[model samples]
Target: NAGVTQTPKFRILKIGQSMTLQCTQDMNHNYMYWYRQDPGMGLKLIYYSVGAGITDKGEVPNGYNVSRSTTEDFPLRLELAAPSQTSVYFCASGRNQPQHFGDGTRLSIL
Candidate 1:
Protein backbone atom coordinates (compact mmCIF):
# COMPACT_ATOMS: atom_id res chain seq x y z
CA ASN A 1 0.00 0.00 0.00
CA ALA A 2 2.29 2.75 -1.21
CA GLY A 3 -0.21 4.58 -3.42
CA VAL A 4 -2.42 2.69 -5.84
CA THR A 5 -3.38 -0.93 -5.28
CA GLN A 6 -6.45 -2.82 -6.39
CA THR A 7 -7.34 -6.48 -6.45
CA PRO A 8 -10.41 -8.62 -6.04
CA LYS A 9 -11.96 -5.75 -4.08
CA PHE A 10 -15.16 -7.16 -5.47
CA ARG A 11 -16.35 -8.77 -8.65
CA ILE A 12 -19.18 -10.79 -10.17
CA LEU A 13 -19.82 -11.42 -13.82
CA LYS A 14 -21.70 -14.04 -15.78
CA ILE A 15 -22.64 -12.55 -19.09
CA GLY A 16 -19.47 -13.76 -20.78
CA GLN A 17 -16.77 -14.12 -18.15
CA SER A 18 -13.35 -12.52 -18.29
CA MET A 19 -11.60 -10.51 -15.62
CA THR A 20 -8.34 -8.73 -15.07
CA LEU A 21 -8.57 -5.60 -12.99
CA GLN A 22 -5.32 -5.13 -11.19
CA CYS A 23 -3.34 -1.91 -10.93
CA THR A 24 -0.21 -1.04 -9.07
CA GLN A 25 1.60 2.20 -8.42
CA ASP A 26 4.52 2.88 -6.14
CA MET A 27 4.15 6.59 -6.66
CA ASN A 28 6.73 6.57 -9.45
CA HIS A 29 4.64 9.08 -11.38
CA ASN A 30 4.27 8.28 -15.03
CA TYR A 31 0.84 9.45 -16.08
CA MET A 32 -1.27 6.34 -15.76
CA TYR A 33 -5.04 6.12 -15.60
CA TRP A 34 -8.15 4.02 -16.06
CA TYR A 35 -11.57 5.03 -14.90
CA ARG A 36 -15.16 3.86 -14.99
CA GLN A 37 -17.65 5.02 -12.42
CA ASP A 38 -21.07 4.88 -13.94
CA PRO A 39 -23.78 5.43 -11.39
CA GLY A 40 -24.12 9.16 -11.32
CA MET A 41 -21.65 10.10 -14.04
CA GLY A 42 -18.16 11.66 -14.02
CA LEU A 43 -15.20 9.32 -14.45
CA LYS A 44 -15.17 7.60 -17.85
CA LEU A 45 -11.70 7.29 -19.29
CA ILE A 46 -11.11 3.58 -19.92
CA TYR A 47 -7.43 3.26 -20.72
CA TYR A 48 -4.30 5.41 -20.52
CA SER A 49 -0.59 4.91 -20.24
CA VAL A 50 2.32 7.25 -20.61
CA GLY A 51 5.22 4.91 -20.09
CA ALA A 52 6.43 1.36 -20.35
CA GLY A 53 5.57 0.27 -23.88
CA ILE A 54 3.01 3.09 -23.95
CA THR A 55 -0.75 2.76 -24.43
CA ASP A 56 -3.77 4.92 -25.09
CA LYS A 57 -7.56 4.95 -25.45
CA GLY A 58 -9.88 6.77 -23.15
CA GLU A 59 -13.52 7.76 -22.81
CA VAL A 60 -14.63 4.17 -22.57
CA PRO A 61 -12.67 1.77 -24.70
CA ASN A 62 -15.37 -0.59 -25.74
CA GLY A 63 -15.39 -3.73 -23.60
CA TYR A 64 -12.20 -2.35 -22.08
CA ASN A 65 -8.54 -3.33 -22.32
CA VAL A 66 -5.23 -1.86 -21.14
CA SER A 67 -1.67 -2.53 -20.09
CA ARG A 68 1.50 -0.62 -19.14
CA SER A 69 4.31 -3.19 -18.97
CA THR A 70 6.22 -1.60 -16.06
CA THR A 71 6.42 1.37 -13.67
CA GLU A 72 4.12 -0.49 -11.41
CA ASP A 73 1.71 -2.56 -13.43
CA PHE A 74 -1.56 -1.26 -14.99
CA PRO A 75 -3.92 -3.97 -16.01
CA LEU A 76 -7.62 -3.69 -16.92
CA ARG A 77 -9.09 -6.01 -19.49
CA LEU A 78 -12.67 -7.11 -19.54
CA GLU A 79 -13.56 -9.04 -22.55
CA LEU A 80 -17.35 -9.88 -22.73
CA ALA A 81 -19.06 -9.55 -19.38
CA ALA A 82 -21.91 -7.22 -20.20
CA PRO A 83 -24.82 -5.83 -18.26
CA SER A 84 -23.59 -2.42 -19.21
CA GLN A 85 -20.23 -3.49 -17.85
CA THR A 86 -21.60 -2.96 -14.40
CA SER A 87 -19.36 -0.17 -13.07
CA VAL A 88 -17.13 0.98 -10.23
CA TYR A 89 -13.55 0.70 -11.36
CA PHE A 90 -10.82 3.22 -10.72
CA CYS A 91 -7.06 3.18 -11.09
CA ALA A 92 -5.05 6.28 -11.73
CA SER A 93 -1.81 8.16 -11.37
CA GLY A 94 -0.24 11.50 -12.31
CA ARG A 95 2.90 13.47 -12.84
CA ASN A 96 1.85 17.06 -13.63
CA GLN A 97 -1.67 17.50 -12.39
CA PRO A 98 -4.16 15.57 -10.31
CA GLN A 99 -4.90 11.85 -10.17
CA HIS A 100 -4.64 9.20 -7.48
CA PHE A 101 -7.31 6.61 -7.16
CA GLY A 102 -7.69 2.95 -6.26
CA ASP A 103 -10.10 1.44 -3.80
CA GLY A 104 -12.74 0.70 -6.27
CA THR A 105 -13.59 -2.34 -8.38
CA ARG A 106 -17.08 -3.37 -7.63
CA LEU A 107 -18.28 -5.10 -10.76
CA SER A 108 -21.49 -6.98 -11.18
CA ILE A 109 -23.17 -8.47 -14.22
CA LEU A 110 -25.99 -10.90 -14.49
Candidate 2:
Protein backbone atom coordinates (compact mmCIF):
# COMPACT_ATOMS: atom_id res chain seq x y z
CA ASN A 1 0.00 0.00 0.00
CA ALA A 2 1.15 3.53 -0.64
CA GLY A 3 2.22 5.34 2.49
CA VAL A 4 2.48 8.90 1.30
CA THR A 5 2.61 10.47 -2.15
CA GLN A 6 3.70 13.87 -3.44
CA THR A 7 3.21 15.27 -6.92
CA PRO A 8 5.32 17.38 -9.28
CA LYS A 9 8.62 16.07 -8.05
CA PHE A 10 10.32 19.08 -9.65
CA ARG A 11 9.13 22.47 -10.74
CA ILE A 12 10.41 25.87 -11.81
CA LEU A 13 8.54 29.06 -11.12
CA LYS A 14 8.99 32.74 -11.84
CA ILE A 15 9.56 35.10 -8.96
CA GLY A 16 5.89 36.04 -8.79
CA GLN A 17 4.38 32.72 -9.72
CA SER A 18 2.46 30.48 -7.37
CA MET A 19 1.79 26.78 -7.07
CA THR A 20 0.47 24.07 -4.85
CA LEU A 21 2.40 21.02 -3.73
CA GLN A 22 0.09 18.07 -3.40
CA CYS A 23 0.41 15.39 -0.73
CA THR A 24 -1.72 12.38 0.03
CA GLN A 25 -1.56 9.45 2.38
CA ASP A 26 -3.49 6.21 2.69
CA MET A 27 -2.76 5.68 6.38
CA ASN A 28 -5.65 7.81 7.54
CA HIS A 29 -3.45 9.92 9.75
CA ASN A 30 -4.79 12.95 11.52
CA TYR A 31 -1.57 14.89 11.81
CA MET A 32 0.05 16.32 8.72
CA TYR A 33 2.88 18.76 8.17
CA TRP A 34 4.68 20.71 5.45
CA TYR A 35 8.38 21.38 5.66
CA ARG A 36 11.07 22.87 3.48
CA GLN A 37 14.76 22.10 3.41
CA ASP A 38 17.41 24.34 1.98
CA PRO A 39 20.64 22.98 0.56
CA GLY A 40 22.66 21.33 3.31
CA MET A 41 20.22 22.56 5.94
CA GLY A 42 17.71 20.90 8.19
CA LEU A 43 13.99 20.93 7.53
CA LYS A 44 11.99 23.95 8.56
CA LEU A 45 8.32 23.59 9.34
CA ILE A 46 6.02 25.68 7.17
CA TYR A 47 2.58 24.59 8.26
CA TYR A 48 0.70 21.75 9.92
CA SER A 49 -2.73 20.42 10.69
CA VAL A 50 -3.96 18.18 13.44
CA GLY A 51 -7.20 17.13 11.79
CA ALA A 52 -9.79 17.96 9.21
CA GLY A 53 -10.97 21.58 9.24
CA ILE A 54 -8.04 22.63 11.42
CA THR A 55 -4.70 24.11 10.40
CA ASP A 56 -1.93 26.27 11.77
CA LYS A 57 1.18 28.08 10.61
CA GLY A 58 4.54 26.73 11.63
CA GLU A 59 7.96 28.22 12.31
CA VAL A 60 8.35 29.42 8.73
CA PRO A 61 4.96 30.14 7.24
CA ASN A 62 5.72 33.23 5.22
CA GLY A 63 4.68 32.88 1.56
CA TYR A 64 3.14 29.49 2.29
CA ASN A 65 -0.16 28.09 3.44
CA VAL A 66 -1.83 24.74 4.13
CA SER A 67 -5.24 23.21 4.59
CA ARG A 68 -6.35 19.88 6.05
CA SER A 69 -9.81 18.98 4.86
CA THR A 70 -9.49 15.22 5.21
CA THR A 71 -7.48 12.54 6.90
CA GLU A 72 -5.73 11.54 3.71
CA ASP A 73 -4.71 14.84 2.12
CA PHE A 74 -2.76 17.91 3.07
CA PRO A 75 -1.58 20.28 0.38
CA LEU A 76 0.83 23.19 0.68
CA ARG A 77 0.29 26.37 -1.32
CA LEU A 78 3.03 28.79 -2.15
CA GLU A 79 2.01 32.34 -2.92
CA LEU A 80 4.10 34.94 -4.72
CA ALA A 81 6.96 32.54 -5.03
CA ALA A 82 10.35 34.03 -4.30
CA PRO A 83 13.96 32.96 -4.72
CA SER A 84 14.20 32.48 -1.01
CA GLN A 85 11.43 29.94 -1.28
CA THR A 86 13.35 27.70 -3.59
CA SER A 87 13.99 24.47 -1.77
CA VAL A 88 12.99 20.85 -1.38
CA TYR A 89 9.63 20.41 0.27
CA PHE A 90 8.47 17.37 2.22
CA CYS A 91 5.05 16.33 3.42
CA ALA A 92 4.52 14.10 6.43
CA SER A 93 1.72 12.41 8.27
CA GLY A 94 1.40 10.42 11.46
CA ARG A 95 -0.53 9.77 14.61
CA ASN A 96 1.26 9.09 17.89
CA GLN A 97 3.58 7.00 15.75
CA PRO A 98 6.59 8.13 13.82
CA GLN A 99 5.76 10.23 10.79
CA HIS A 100 6.01 8.94 7.26
CA PHE A 101 7.38 11.27 4.58
CA GLY A 102 6.62 11.68 0.92
CA ASP A 103 9.18 11.94 -1.83
CA GLY A 104 10.17 15.60 -1.68
CA THR A 105 9.19 18.18 -4.26
CA ARG A 106 12.05 20.27 -5.56
CA LEU A 107 11.08 23.85 -6.30
CA SER A 108 13.13 26.51 -7.98
CA ILE A 109 12.24 30.18 -8.26
CA LEU A 110 13.95 32.35 -10.81
Candidate 3:
Protein backbone atom coordinates (compact mmCIF):
# COMPACT_ATOMS: atom_id res chain seq x y z
CA ASN A 1 0.00 0.00 0.00
CA ALA A 2 3.02 2.27 0.31
CA GLY A 3 6.72 2.73 -0.39
CA VAL A 4 9.79 3.98 1.46
CA THR A 5 10.49 7.70 1.65
CA GLN A 6 13.65 9.47 2.81
CA THR A 7 14.26 13.15 3.43
CA PRO A 8 17.16 15.51 2.79
CA LYS A 9 18.30 13.77 -0.36
CA PHE A 10 21.69 15.45 0.18
CA ARG A 11 23.46 17.07 3.09
CA ILE A 12 26.85 18.50 4.12
CA LEU A 13 27.99 18.56 7.69
CA LYS A 14 31.07 19.60 9.60
CA ILE A 15 32.86 17.10 11.79
CA GLY A 16 31.14 16.79 15.18
CA GLN A 17 27.78 18.00 13.98
CA SER A 18 24.75 15.81 14.57
CA MET A 19 21.76 15.06 12.39
CA THR A 20 18.93 12.62 11.92
CA LEU A 21 18.17 10.90 8.63
CA GLN A 22 14.45 10.48 8.26
CA CYS A 23 12.80 7.35 6.86
CA THR A 24 9.18 6.41 6.54
CA GLN A 25 7.10 3.69 4.99
CA ASP A 26 3.40 3.31 4.47
CA MET A 27 3.26 -0.35 3.51
CA ASN A 28 2.54 -1.46 7.10
CA HIS A 29 5.55 -3.73 7.06
CA ASN A 30 6.85 -5.37 10.18
CA TYR A 31 10.49 -5.16 9.11
CA MET A 32 12.40 -1.96 8.52
CA TYR A 33 16.07 -1.36 7.86
CA TRP A 34 18.80 1.20 7.46
CA TYR A 35 21.91 0.73 5.38
CA ARG A 36 24.92 2.78 4.37
CA GLN A 37 26.83 2.33 1.15
CA ASP A 38 30.28 3.77 0.76
CA PRO A 39 31.79 4.49 -2.60
CA GLY A 40 32.59 1.36 -4.58
CA MET A 41 31.33 -0.78 -1.71
CA GLY A 42 28.22 -2.76 -1.05
CA LEU A 43 25.60 -1.69 1.43
CA LYS A 44 26.29 -2.34 5.10
CA LEU A 45 23.35 -2.75 7.39
CA ILE A 46 23.30 -0.15 10.12
CA TYR A 47 20.26 -1.22 12.04
CA TYR A 48 16.91 -2.99 11.81
CA SER A 49 13.62 -3.33 13.59
CA VAL A 50 11.35 -6.29 13.48
CA GLY A 51 8.38 -4.25 14.58
CA ALA A 52 7.37 -1.23 16.57
CA GLY A 53 9.24 -0.73 19.85
CA ILE A 54 11.99 -3.19 18.89
CA THR A 55 15.38 -2.66 17.30
CA ASP A 56 18.79 -4.29 16.87
CA LYS A 57 22.23 -3.42 15.66
CA GLY A 58 23.52 -4.58 12.34
CA GLU A 59 26.94 -4.90 10.70
CA VAL A 60 27.89 -1.23 10.94
CA PRO A 61 25.92 0.17 13.84
CA ASN A 62 28.64 2.39 15.18
CA GLY A 63 28.00 6.12 14.86
CA TYR A 64 24.36 5.50 14.25
CA ASN A 65 21.18 5.00 16.21
CA VAL A 66 17.67 3.97 15.21
CA SER A 67 14.24 3.88 16.74
CA ARG A 68 10.98 2.32 15.65
CA SER A 69 8.24 4.06 17.54
CA THR A 70 5.61 3.14 14.96
CA THR A 71 5.54 0.72 12.07
CA GLU A 72 5.65 3.59 9.61
CA ASP A 73 8.74 5.37 10.95
CA PHE A 74 12.37 4.36 11.46
CA PRO A 75 14.81 7.20 11.79
CA LEU A 76 18.60 6.96 11.86
CA ARG A 77 20.48 9.35 14.10
CA LEU A 78 24.09 10.37 13.72
CA GLU A 79 25.87 12.02 16.61
CA LEU A 80 29.19 13.78 16.24
CA ALA A 81 29.32 13.24 12.53
CA ALA A 82 32.68 12.14 11.14
CA PRO A 83 34.28 12.11 7.75
CA SER A 84 34.33 8.33 7.73
CA GLN A 85 30.58 8.38 8.11
CA THR A 86 30.02 10.00 4.78
CA SER A 87 28.02 7.76 2.50
CA VAL A 88 24.69 7.18 0.86
CA TYR A 89 22.03 6.02 3.30
CA PHE A 90 19.10 3.92 2.25
CA CYS A 91 15.89 3.07 4.07
CA ALA A 92 13.93 -0.06 3.30
CA SER A 93 10.92 -1.96 4.50
CA GLY A 94 9.35 -5.33 3.81
CA ARG A 95 7.71 -8.42 5.22
CA ASN A 96 10.89 -10.43 4.89
CA GLN A 97 13.87 -9.10 2.98
CA PRO A 98 13.68 -5.46 1.98
CA GLN A 99 11.20 -4.90 -0.81
CA HIS A 100 11.32 -1.12 -1.08
CA PHE A 101 14.16 1.38 -0.91
CA GLY A 102 14.05 5.15 -0.75
CA ASP A 103 15.91 7.30 -3.22
CA GLY A 104 18.79 7.52 -0.70
CA THR A 105 20.42 10.30 1.27
CA ARG A 106 23.85 11.42 0.16
CA LEU A 107 25.73 12.67 3.23
CA SER A 108 29.09 14.37 3.28
CA ILE A 109 31.14 15.27 6.33
CA LEU A 110 33.74 17.97 6.16
TM-score of each: 0.32, 0.96, 0.97
Candidate 1: list runs displaced more than 4 Å. 1-4, 15-20, 27-51, 54-66, 69-73, 80-110
Enumerate residue pairs that collide in model 3.
Answer: none
lDDT of 1 by residue, 11-100 (tens): 888999989999898989888888889988898888888888798898779988887889789999898899999989988888844378
The superposed Cα distance between candidate 3 and the true structure at residue 55, in angstroms, equals 0.3
In candidate 1, residue 87 scores what lDDT?
89
Going through the candidates in order, what is the number of backbone clashes in each?
0, 0, 0
Question: What would the C-alpha RMSD of candidate 1 be, to one decimal place?
Answer: 11.6
Model 2: CA > 4 A from native: none
What local lDDT score does residue 90 receive in model 3, on the 0 to 100 scale? Answer: 98
Question: Alpha carbon lDDT of residue 24, candidate 2?
Answer: 95
- Model 2 over residues 9-96: C-alpha lDDT tens digits? 9999999998999999999888888999999999998988888999988899999988888889999998899999999999998994
